[model samples]
Target: MNSESAILFTQCLQNDFTSLLDKYDPLPNSLHIGYAEANRLLGEMVEDGPVFSLMDWAYEKDPKQLKLIHIRDWHDPKSKSQEDHLLQFGEHCLMDTKGAEFVFQSWIEENPNRAEIVNASGLNDFVDTNLESILKPYKGKSIRVGITGVWTEAKVTFLCYDLKTRYPEFEIAVCSALTASSSLSMHFIALDQLKQILGVNVFSSIGAFTEFLTGDQPNLKKRISTNARIASDKLNLDPKYPITDLDKQILLYLFRDCKEVECKTLDGGFSGNVVLKTKSIDHLGHLQVPCVVKIGNRDLIAKERTSFERIQEVLGNNAPSIVDFCELGDRGAIKYRYAAMLDGNVKTFQKLYGTMLDGSGLDRVIDTVFGEQLGRLFEAASTEKLNLLEYYDFQHKYAKSVRNRVETILGSPQNESTIEIFPGHIVQNPCLFYETDLLDLKEYNAISHNTSYVHGDLNGANIIIDAQDNVWMIDFFHTHRGHIIRDLLKLENDILYIFCKIETESEWNDAIVLTDFLHNQEDLGIPLSFDPPREITNEKLKKAYRVHRKTQIVLS
Candidate 1:
């Protein structure tokens, strides 16, 4: 292997061993190995060979000096087989002092070069404390120390007390020794005592410890930062919008405007209503205020708040729209903005299979909206058409540059395939399953045709209907040049999920009819001949529903 590859492998092994030692206890007469599989594999490699054959081979050749021989709990049965025979012979010989001395001499004579001959009873003393000390600097950093010995109640109490007092910040974990015919009652009692003494908050599972040390823990600070970024990105608004001077100015103007209005306070005086009589349109949050703000002028919907319009011109249209921000008398404060339709109306699917929408009419409306978007996309792609080879070169160049960011947001690519499309398909039959065939289409387009700008998140929630019943889109932060089928697959998947929840055969039939109309939209330009229709089977739907139910249970 190349040096780079070898170094990577060594790092992985080090991480694995370091992780194991952190969570488990290495006790006397008990095995201390990184993983059970490694120990088992090693034993199998040297089962019929000379003593320490595998160890000698690995140590003699490897430059990292990874010469440690570890016996794990699972291999104790095999290790005990040899130790038991020796003990039986020694016990018999011990009946006579001269015989016992002879047995010992013969045993030492056979293995003169051996570092130590330890039995189950004496294994604790054989523990290499110096080896543990070598790992001390790594403590609370990445490596977890596992100390296993024949544990007593008193020993457990003292150990927990000493460790908590000595290393209060360090993540200390413990696991009981698993040996032949071992009873864990004492271990359980010791664990309970440790928890009571050390405080239960510090206690965590091995997996939790690993995640915490790796910086994967969902701390409040990390969560808030992540949420802020996600919200800004989803809205296609500037990241600094909420904290910008423009936003502050808009808030101050809104507060001033409200002060001029005849405000009405509701019961308990917690929330009040304001009626601002102004010729200028009130732009509140992202929505045109006339819709959400009752008693506002309907004709003034196009008007913008004075301060907001000035700031919008300066900061550009991408800044988040502010509504009202004011400090109430004696009360803390209040801020209101246009609540996203998705935030207020979008219901999370309780079951993977459930009637998501009431009827086929909804599906048709969705199909039409997406079809129009696809038409615009095709026009854009036509304007940028190039030769097949050049297109492929450009597609790959672009995708490769942004591949890391894409993977971070949408998850890693599962597989890549290439599609062979005829030239006629570009203008005459451009429709294809975009979401499911994105990677394939990208590769094919690079080798065959030009690409188009596609909305990456084309699911139903991104499609919104206003109070006026006009359909609008919200999230388009992931728009990129790709095939049209990506949008279709997203739409189909959404509809499929909704249809799968139909309770009756008639409902299923109607769903299929609606899906067929969507599948055959001329504006969409999808191929008529494609995958065969399958029954919307309920068994899979029930299973999905059950899983979703379980997830809700856990989340709640």
Candidate 2:
């Protein structure tokens, strides 16, 4: 309706047409001849024929102009043939007419308006002179050329070859005097002969519509993509991916949703899921925005679907908007509003910052961008409340697993020396022990505080920042009511991971100290910050060191 929307619609139409046209324009395959070589070969065949004379007639009663060719064999109609003589004559005719009729018929069929060959004719003039000049008038236009007389497969092949190569824009057809039945017989025999003598499968040639004769022929029934057959055992499917009907229906459904939208298939490789992007408009036309269509296996996504439904009920506009959700047999598709302004995430920011925190004027930038934003986030979480009993239940369920994970990493005697894991030790045993220790500390266990709504996966990649610097969280596949500190720690480790990736052990330590200082800043809103080494003891450094070392190992 609007200019931008109209433009997008037009572009979509263009793309759809472009894609469809590709189906008709097949590349030259094994069955097709090289255009130039075909023309030359056809010319040679015609030139080697028994000499023929051409007669031109301008009709007096009609506007028709016709040319008739009298071949040496055709000129001997009056001769009565003995048995052996008749066979010899027939054989000679077949040889001479081999490729002639094919070329003539093709030309006549293709060039109805501009060119015509009324009867068998000698190729002496046409071949000796520039053939290009003879058909020059029909060069840029579609013309119909009429051809008559019986021809062998060899002649038909030659004729078809010449017409296709020399006058591509012309349509060739048999004369009306030649009935459709007669033409069909001629064509059938022509193809048979061509195959037998020339090894050319006319039906398999490029641009030929012979799909109906092949196993790969497309299914023409109307249906959804579910009917398609999966090609291999590796692909998750019912029977297998089909060649025709299902593919068309999918495109049709997509077109119906967003009139001029183009789909980019982003299948979850080996996951048996199909993801696509389309201009967002549902069957009911509620919203006209870009959206993602995720079609997943019903068996795999039942829990995920429940999670999405729950999130929609609880978060409202704080999360991505769901458009249409439907189940098509065993699989389902969910259309959700897509964000066009999503710039990048936390990982993006850290990678961009690089070692800039070590550079001048950047420390102030870091304080403003990260320190202030994180401070606000923590402050926001503190104001939210969670049920006390539910909080304890979550802590109890994960406490033992956390303890085991910590013990496994730190239990090894070889992990005692810091030098053994100095660089990226954060992901190693020492880091795990530190996290587990923090969980077990009396200060953490003694407090009965409200657990708030927290992003379950709070990594930098999950946090999307827009052009205006506003942050948004995505991928709530893991959303749950969890501890506020869990989100905070995840964000901290993400930031630390970046440093470990680019900085040495000393640089990593300096970054860890800076992060600690920012969290401890006055009014920064964190419930608690890293204590000084004298207070928490130098043992805390081992955790930070382990975090860096683990990060290094994973990256390597």
Candidate 3:
């Protein structure tokens, strides 16, 4: 690596801590220190999700720009720190064992020439290792050195202090989110000391560290435009969504002086709004905050703005605060700066379904979601009525997509005349419904219900849950008059099809029957019963249904 290049020296990402995170066996204090963190340290490396893996991201961005150095705790039989360490932290990281190996040792194995591996038995990485020599090349060259790992109080502290004292010329910084400790108190105290006494820079995230490394004077306009182009493909983005050059300029003026601005698309696409979650330093406060920008056509933005205002007025903190809105002739944007997000994130309702079900306050959870907040939110929005036929226009539009997907999975006849989904069941020609004859019955016309100013499209994907269990809903473009039970129906869909795990065809069938029976009473306004068909025996669906059924009954 050159003098101008940065070095990412990750420490103690060993199986001893990372793997023990999901086990029933007891762990040592050394491992517990990092495990007790609110956000698990180094978890991005192991987790499979939309998370940005710092190492992998760097590798993908440009492997040669950032050099890698790893520190692993290896305690051999004749190790130097064995006498003192044995009694203190107990047996761990024994040499030649998997516990002593780096959790991502394959990284070193794959890039043997680019990656450096240093073994240490003590808290300080420099204590009996060649980390100093490995870093000697970058000394006094104005290169940024980032340190991230476990046991932030001890191991992370010792390294930061020693690295600065030895080579004060090299800028040393720690990515706080990447580093963790088993003891929350000690970890924070150590970070405070590291910054105050040692003059070490503490970055809240990798984006900030990357910003410092690049030394960009930062044009917020350029960052937004650049990232917009990087994420230009419309696959995940809202269809036909465009952040026009004028829109980019507006975003620049909107998020003025924001530094380290990193932009990426979120998971869902609904309401003709393409959402981008971006992390940036607040110009006024100079603190990292993640803001979401929703870009859509002008008509959708205008409607959403009005809907957001109404929901915020009625629900108060239950709704996310709208940062600003930009009107760009045919297209516009809604930027939301969430105030409560310390780390600028909350788990999606889909991600935390298990947490909500397994929570201690079942009554509070049900009441808060169904009775108190969202129930009131549904009341506050609008009141429009449409019979099933009119609603079919929207439903049928969605069914076309589902039909195409099913055809892709199970090839149909060339004419699509008779598509058999099961042994005796078929989605005949046009409407793909098992009961295709029901369309001519004219019974759905008699069943009419007021689609109150409800979140027209409600789903677990757009619902947000924070650490405090407070709910936040997004994607307000569809926040107009809709079905009275639209929100509840969406929640049920998540509990059954989205979150519940049904392995066998029988289980899925049972889930379908259960959901259909329960949801069939939406127009009748009838009280629900918890009983299921005697033949139904899917324990996963049954368990999830029990939670949904109780909430549904109470809300209904």
TM-score winner among the candidates?
A: 3
Which parts of model 3 have CA positions greater than 4 angstroms off? 1-251, 257-280, 284-291, 296-299, 327-331, 354-366, 378-385, 392-420, 424-448, 512-534
Which lDDT tens digits does candidate 1 get at residues 152-188?
2433344445545554554444422111011233444
Can you write out model 2's per-residue Cα lDDT over 1-556, one digit (the tens) per residue? 1111000000000111111112245423221223322221222223211010000111111223232221222212334433354344332222223322333333234445533322222322244334445455456455444332233233344554566566666444421111111123344456555446544333211101111111121121222233323122212222333222333343343334332444444334445565554443344544455555566553334334334433343344445555443333344445566444332222233433343332232233334323343333334444344454344343444555655665566564333323233345343344434445435542433444534445556565455444444444444455554565555556557755643354355555665564565455563242332333332223334344443333222212
TM-score of each: 0.25, 0.34, 0.46
Model 2 alpha-carbon drift over 4 Å, by segment: 1-256, 263-287, 293-302, 308-316, 326-333, 338-420, 423-447, 466-471, 498-500, 503-506, 509-556
Candidate 2 at residue 326, lDDT?
34
Error of 2 at 454 (Å): 2.3
Q: Sorted on TM-score, highest at the top, how do the candidates line up?
A: 3, 2, 1
Tens-digit lDDT track of model 3 for 1-556:
4533777777787777554353344564356443324224543224210112455554443445677777888887676647687668777888888777766666556767767789887776777788878777677677788888776777778887787777878788885556767654455567778889989987643445555655421233433454332222311223344545665554564454453455556643454556776666553547565667777665466467545543554666666666555444455677786666545456766666666534323445556667776787555545444666555453444555666766677776324566666665564554444224334533454455655656666677676655556565678766655677777766766677778877788886886677667656664456555665566676666667566767767666
Q: Show where candidate 1 strays beyond 4 Å.
A: 1-359, 383-445, 495-556
Report residue 67 deviation for candidate 3 (angstroms): 62
Question: Which of the two, 2 or 3, has more TM-score?
Answer: 3
Better of 2 and 3 by lDDT: 3
Model 2 scores worst on lDDT over the 10 consecutive residues at 4-13
TM-score of 2: 0.34
